[model samples]
Target: MDLDKVSFNGQIVDMTEDEDTMAVEAHVRALVLLEDALKKKEWLLLDREIEYEKSQELDPNCPFLHQQLVLNLFHKLQEVQLLKNGDSAGKTYVYPNPDSVNIFLGQSFWESKEYLEQWSRPGTLILAASQILGYRNVAGTLTASDIYAAFETWMNHNGIYKNGIYTCCGEALRDSVCKESSMSHSLLPYMNEFDETDLKKATLDILWDCQKKCLLVEHIEKPQALLAIPEFPIITTSLVQELIEKLKQVKFKCDTRADKIAYTDPRTRNIIYVGNHFWKQKDYLSCGSRLGTIILYVAQLLEHPHLFDGATKDITSETTVEHQGSNSPRSFQEPLNESIHNHDRDPPLPLKNSTPSNIGDALFNKSKSETYGKCKHTADTICAAFEKWMSHKGSYENESYTCCMETARHSVCNKSVMRSCLSELESRLKDFV
Candidate 1:
């Protein structure tokens, strides 16, 4: 066969008939076509069609016919700048780190044989770049501009250009870095602590902050209360307000209906008696009265030691008994012996099955009949409110539940014991219902 000849920069060179020489020539020809296609921004031309074209001119059986071989050959060409020597008058481009370039191009090739096949579609490049940069640590010393420039060059060479592509690329890169940094350092500690819902919320919040503020990953603040154990049946100002409103409703019911109920019945009379004493306290609506005193009364009524342990805060004279450290919920069944009245014959009977309306009527009659009393409407509201509060499902049904829990965890109860106690109190109330 006549010795084959190939042209480089218009210089015709004789090629030997050796198979190795043909392979080298094929490799060189492939590189030439690749560089031309890149310079002209012909992405489609770099696909398998071009490979078949090279195979026609050179030996189809050559080892360098595969795409991987083409990539390896490209890497060698870039390393030696052999192609740049072929163009004395062409502009010299400053290449980024060869490894980054390989990654960028290698990803483009392995992921899709066509250079811009997938990337040419909107947002695909940015999405791929974000995932790669965020999840994988392949962006060594590559700035947003560096990646953008590489992408721009690639696209420009393929005769494709868009106005906001650079900005989008930069944003994607920035977000990826921020996400990786935040997740790895700031949020990592609390990640395991959060349940699925909380984790999702926290992650979305962090991502929002990163994208919206363009914050540095290190600058992203850890979510507040992420590590803190949340208080069950969280108490809130709204919750307290709701409780107070409910109390007012109970008082209204009592004031309007006291005359209708027969006071001779033990259950009916006890409801009125306990309700009467509850409404008599001066601090009936006070935090100590509502949260502490009422909680204590319920514990006393239920005879639950766990409730008493959790609810025993000094709210009124009736709740004078101090909490003795008891492990069992059954240990403290006896009601506190203190009296809300000086002339009391017997402590009012526990209204375990009494309705809120009955308790309200009792409160109204007690307030009307009593001349002097220390703990008045406080106890009444406690009983009435407990009935109403527990009648619904768990505390989660209350609109104020979340806010109260957050408040308890973040502000009101700093100690875990206090939170546990409050939780215990709420649990007992639910069980009582």
Candidate 2:
């Protein structure tokens, strides 16, 4: 026999020099020819039993050869049935049993070393498959039954059954519908259940909302003016200002107002009564009433001090006091006693040659060398950077500011001038709010 010119299924076959390579190639060609015969509907011309016997005799160890023969036999049987019943049978034709096909394919293809190698790193691959193919109960060795179960679950989860068929609702619409349906009516009920981390997240969320709404400023006289979430109650302006003061001391580590006495002081009773009247028209004082709102708005201002940048400029322009000898505004000088008592008039402006007490003075008045001796930059540069930092909204990391070459947190000037500037800003915000 001429091995190079041997013919099988009407196609010429070329045999290679290596015996093992020739055998494998011959088996692969036979499988491909069988698939081509099935696709071309040449079942009547092919003898199923004879072909199966031939494949077995040729390569009994080749699972693919046996699988192809079995599939060819199945198609032949279906063709026989169809021809016997004519056109009517074609209308009622049934698909191959998926479970049976799965079992056959798993045994013949998936069990092969090539396919097994694909799943060697199965964690991410299996997870991605499960998202589209449904969850697998076992990860080690997947069976035909496991695949069938996964398909069934995936169909059920992603499709609606109608007219004896499953119609898939795509992932996008499903996600949007799920989001819309899952929204909670109120977060207040869960407040008590929140741990420290959860409370922090909730507080941050509320502060972010306030920041967006521009409600974190000094004044919020009416509860109705705040964000209208049912979970948060209305608050009085006095309580809002009080919370701002407390937060200033806590957040900025600035000096507290001299007049700000403790809650237990006899002086606080009148202040409490005045604050109560502000919210009494809306609702009476109760436990946790408007407390959450108070914390939220206060946190927003403390967390985002840059919100006051525009207002700071406006305050500076309105309070600028020029000296006779120079065009520049002098340091503001307001006695602590007068500032504490004066509530009806506009805040005093910076005056030349006056003693420094508030933020205005700290900004215009030059700091002594002793006060800022540890600083690498000059006093003027530090003061300029401090003003720039007030207007700056970005992160406050060390070496972030180009002017001072250091951050306020690390600067020695933070003790005197920086501290006073923060305190003055808070005081000014309180006057306006």
Candidate topping lDDT: 1
TM-score for predicted model 2 compared with the true structure: 0.15
Which ten residues in a row are the worst by lDDT in model 2?
A: 179-188
lDDT of 2 by residue, 285-333 (tens): 1112122322322432322111221111111221211100011211221
TM-score of each: 0.15, 0.15
lDDT for 369 (candidate 2): 17
Candidate 1 deviant stretches above 4 angstroms: 1-234, 237-241, 252-276, 284-433
For residues 372-407, write the lDDT of model 1, one tens digit per residue: 122123333333232222212223333333424422
| Candidate 2: residue 8 Cα off by (Å) | 38
Q: What are the clash counts of all predictions, listed in order?
A: 24, 2
lDDT comparing candidate 2 with the true structure: 0.24
